[model samples]
Target: MANITLFAQAIGRLPKECIRKIIREEKTDKHSKGYDTWSQFISMMFCQFSGCDSVRDISNGLNSANGNLNHLGICRAPSKSTVAYQNAKRDSGVFRRIFYALLAHFGQQAVWQRTRYRFKMPIKLLDSSTITLTMSLYEWAHYTTRKGGGEDAYIA
Candidate 1:
């Protein structure tokens, strides 16, 4: 049996061909030194999913994933310096273009599917409310244990 991590499965579902096409057009991997655009993307995705707060955290996390790196399409986990360098030097537009490409790819499926209900024009609903603040911020406002503050209101 082949051992695969859930992360690999998730990454596999992404439109890699679309991303590669964009990377080719954008020349995102021109200055890379072994660390390709695909690796950079996987690292960022791991950072987000793992809630890593620093480059060191991402490097350590990937390294700890052990043999699973190959399943994620990375030969090896990147070092802290390499990840940081690529992050700082790589064009963010490549990722942005990839996002739009994936969005368009998946969004078209939703657009073609018919819903049970239809509207003549598009509709938008907005829910806005005021948030209450502590009494220190609103001294002039009326304050009661039951109702809370009156004058201090934050619109959300």
Candidate 2:
């Protein structure tokens, strides 16, 4: 299989204290009797904060790697099925709460820090300067050709 343990380890090097605090303050009790809350959910977010884009990718990445997540107290790196089950079983309110909290915190920070310059809305300039006639002519010439009794031309 492709080796990713070293890469995972590198990501794991993020300060332990920082990870613990985020999990502690932002997370809920794991060993509760009634429901599953932050414990299971945090791993997925941790994967994202470490730059995993999707649960499927995180599942694949963690399923292969070792030492990194375990060090963060993810004793068992869950499979996709297990994660799906956990997600299905849990109270979705927890996810909503986390999402809103994240958005609010970032929003407040943006306002207070006045890094509006950095957070400014992106501007896109799509000018005719970059447009070329070559592509237009090529498409019109190549695509307009009648094929399959002109049905293909109509589809194009």
The TM-score values for the models, in the order shown, are 0.67, 0.47
Positional deviation of 132 in candidate 1, in angstroms? 9.3
Candidate 2 C-alpha lDDT tens digits along 1-156: 856554445445444444345545644445544323544655566576568776677677666654655554566567676666676765565566666666665577668887435546676554332222344445543333442111121211
- Pairs clashing within candidate 2: none
Off by over 4 Å in 2: 1-36, 46-56, 70-73, 114-140, 144-156
Tens digit of per-residue lDDT, candidate 1, span 44-79: 999988899999999999999967888777899999
lDDT of each: 0.84, 0.54
- Highest-TM-score candidate: 1
Evaluated with lDDT, which candidate comes out highest?
1
